[model samples]
Target: MTAWETERVAWAYLSRVTQGPSRVVSDFVERYGVVEAVRAIKSGVVPRVVAERVSARAHIDTAAADLDAVAALGGRLVIPTDDEWPAWRLVGFQTGEFGGRADTSVPLALWVIGGRSLLDVTERAVAVVGTRAATAYGEHVAGEISGDMAVDGWTVVSGGAFGIDGVAHRAAMGVGGVTVAVLACGVDRAYPAGHARLLQQITSSGLVVSEYALGTTPAKHRFLARNRLVAAFGEGVVVVEAGWRSGARNTASWARSLGRPVVAVPGPVTSASSAGCHRMIRESEARLVSNARDVVEEIGSALSGDDEQDHLFSRGDDRITGPAILVLDALPGSGSLGPHEISELSGVPMSDVRAALVMLEMESLVVRDDTGWARAQRRR
Candidate 1:
């Protein structure tokens, strides 16, 4: 078979052999060798371990079914060999079996649905993850950090769940900035149905991606697995609002394992929701971020170029147009605005405001603060 055909068949076997989506492809390579693994799978004589893993685990078939379902839904499955695959996956994969106690997982492939190029977007990306049961403080802080990150021309990557995840994605999309959603389930299946429309919006404007295949339904453990991808794919992981034992903490641990920088947003000392972040900061495992500019300055060296500001906020635009520029102009020199405020000031519809903020934020021209509003960063 051709290389692509081999990859496709190997993926098919991958769908069948591994119980967990995290190791499906990599394990196939480890056990059978890449080429032989694909051949064995197509020949229907997959190893006994592979067969046992596939047959015994309900998730194995569910993972494969996800691929089939996505194919049926007009979504394409992207394997490692795919041209569009993000190169950042290598960072996580290379971090295997560290001296540290914590182990981070990596996915074999990504399933993406969106206009944005995952590779292009992640060239300068940062992840913002936090509690699902976020507080007003958490949500507000998440919005600001994520929004400002987007303004700096850094794509914001996160889990596509509620609270911090939803708000982070919204902050990026609100500004027409490129954001990527790393899902625990299939790209075709939108879990947390409340975010269905948001998922659609992401696929259209940014990217909705998964390591899991198409039809796989999300289980509790899957989110933890997905968290690794979120951490691994970015330059660093920022925790905006995580509680003690929050899943976002898992992502933070993964970031630590990979030697990626971690940033946390401080919240009310008495709030249970703030405990996790405080612990991270107190432990010195994460740096504390009070606003978007801090996040930028913290990771500023990792950013591709100082010229990102000129690219994002330029007025005599050629490719960029309309609301993106207006939102850029709307940002004040300090103290960020929430999406609503950005909308009001930019005269861009509330719907487009977030996307604009994301664009400007990723380019490093704007930032969001604890108040959850976008503001222009005060440059030296």
Candidate 2:
């Protein structure tokens, strides 16, 4: 084998044997080159902390098997020196402390499965993350924003979990846009199992990536560690919905620490799922984003020197007009209400309410079902 391939295999082996925070592995690789570091670990001359956790002498065979398994799966191992690695931006996060984990470090290697390069796929990526138990409103907003971003040639990045993540991926794919799924488990192993099909679709058009070796299962700590990768990979992160203690909050924190812009979509006041997003906005940690336009503006400003006015939210004249606006606003986000109920709530005359509802229905701003009327799913 070539010298580069030999070193790549050794780095992959080290990734399998190392445990107890990524900083230990990162520091070792930094202090000694990949080949020399592997030799030191095998010779039992490494630091006491790492040595205690990594019994390299015992797991050498398994590590070799892990490399073989990845190869069998057609997975690519990308190290720091690889041309396809996104080192320019990821290097910044690796050198900084995040989530109070001083031991946190950049991944030793990334296992990717896809046809596109990691650097190219994430060149203009934006992460849309949120709760696994998402509300309908949250899902709608996530899908709309993700779809718009994809149509504009920006890749959507997210954890391959259910709820918002699934919606975002589907939306981007629906528009024939690229997306990247950063996984806590091996790229070959789908954690939610239900998203197996979704992950397959992503790999066909984009990429599925992880830091763990093949066969590694998803764990609580691994997910937490994986959050940093999601945050660091995107130029900015948008939290669609998150509870008080959601994993999405961890990603937002990492984005802030990495000097990346954080945006939060506001949810109804009564939703517990939106508590974390509201808190972030109130604390000035994240800007409020109501639609795709808001997201594009925020991300564009952060990414380029273009004038803000040049990228303003451009909703065409198709926006709801006249009494239709009042009637549409009167509708509840959840259940439907009749015209009389909407008239009473909106203070519009009954005659005007009926006329506005007709106009709104034709424009798809509202829908009339067997129960009554409700706001239609409008994508902006």
Candidate 3:
């Protein structure tokens, strides 16, 4: 084997020997390169931190077998050295804070199943995630947002499970758009068993990715580990509906840490399934997104430049389109007016007026009441 071929086996070995977010392993590889790091790790001549994390699995070197197994399944391991590796996404990922407990770092290798490149689908991706115990309203919202995004050539990333995740995958695919499913188990396995057909279809054009080696079973910790990647792959993460302790909420946390924009869809206050989303909004951890447009705007704001002004009221921000600005300027500062009145005053079409109002409402610059729409009270 050539040097790179040998390095590929080393990457596969490190991936199996160490779980995700292992800073020591990442640093070791960065310092000494993949081949040398694997030798030192296997020979028990590494740093204590690396030793602690890899000692248990160091003896297990199924690099060749694992590579062949995944290849047999029409997949391959994407290491950092690969030309298509998405180094841009991990630009400023602060692994230290996240890895303090899990003792992991950025993904060493992603086992991916799909003909399309990982960067291609993930380049303009957004994560639409929510509760497994979804309500009719929740599922509907997830589908609408995900479908709209997919149609606009933006890929949807999500955990491959029931409810919202399943809805996102199906919606993205329904529109003939690309989507990536970040699996908690091995890519070779069909998790949830029920979504076997869904997983199989995803691999047809989109991607099914995982950190776990082949044949690894799904577990709670593995799912948590998988959440980080789902958050990372997306430029932004949208939580459609989440309960008090949903995994979707956890993904949102990862998004925040990764500096990825976090958006949430509100549900009826009475619905237990939406409580998590509401809480995130209340805590200011996530921006409230009611529709696809709101999601797009937020994601655009985050990617455009410094995100500190994402929630700030900037008159020049591109997120504030001309129609929205006109709509805002047309509104009476003290009172309210209906859409027709606003459209007439702003010289914007009715359709544009309505769209602008929704965008304004999401930005907290406008509010709709029983009477009509009015400028929201500005904070001091």
Candidate 4:
């Protein structure tokens, strides 16, 4: 068969619901030409070669009807040649590390949905992932980092699951920023049905993506495999919270292997939720980030260290002297303080305090949650 026909057959085979059998067929096609591979599968001669690799079954016929159905489900079956396919995928797939197996298991096609194209969104993206049973602190930090990245014109990417992943997606959406959910399941059937609405919002504002085809269910192992794509697509990976064997840490490992920067959030010393993060820091696998600015500064420094020195969070040309600056310094990290309280704490006049508060609020430098104003976005 021609190369085009071979690729189409490979894609079609990979899109089937059956996993091992389809992979065997696809691998055979990938190794040899499609005509010979199809003949081997049909003649049952291919099973012995892959008998130790996967449980084989009869060759499944490719169907136009199934391909059409995938399209009808708002899914785009994208090949490497597609205009919207990420150029990075070519580079990523060629690496063959971290379960990527570019030689054997590179995705034949990806199913995509949502507003931003995969290629466009991945250009300025970061992955924020962690344990599904993350602590409250983990979720909070993920939201802050993801939200800030979104506002800074970077897409926040994560798997659309519970805990840190969900928090990141919600916070980005709250700020009218783009967030993409990279799923292990098909985009048509957003797994963890609880995130259905959140996934819809994401699709409207950004995208929901997966390597699986339409009507596929999420598998435990698939998510571990999915982390590779999250790492492959992002410039960096941030682990907000993780345990000894958390999947987020898996992504971090993959990111490091791929030569991307990794960042980890520091939490309470006693909390098991943060043990993995601390370990990462100790092992020199990632940098510690207390707030969004720390992350931005790191990324900016990598791009151009000079740009980082240009801005120093100063109120003026001097080190520090503005009411807003003083107010921010005085506010508590976890809770809000009213204008009167802030005025008292900063020792600034009430009127100046009020004006600074307003200005800060307008710039989203501070937020008022029922009681009073406090730092909104994390300090740079």
Q: How accurate is candidate 2 locally (lDDT)?
A: 0.79
Please provide the root mean square deviation of candidate 1 (C-alpha atoms, Å). 14.9
Clashes of each: 36, 0, 4, 0
Per-model TM-score on C-alpha atoms: 0.71, 0.77, 0.79, 0.69
Clashes of 3: 4
Reference-based lDDT, each prediction: 0.70, 0.79, 0.84, 0.69
TM-score-based ranking, best first? Answer: 3, 2, 1, 4
The positional error of residue 169 in candidate 3, measured at the CA in angstroms, is 0.1
- Candidate 3 structure, TM-score to reference: 0.79
- Point out the higher-scoring one by lDDT: 1 or 3: 3
Query: Tens digit of lDDT per residue, candidate 3, span 311-364?
Result: 221233446654676677778758999999998765578998899999989887
TM-score: which is higher, 1 or 4? 1
lDDT of 2 at 106: 69
In model 2, residue pairs whose N, Cα or C atoms come closer than 3 Å (at least 3 residues apart or on different chains), thus clashing, are: none
Comparison by lDDT, 2 against 4, better one: 2
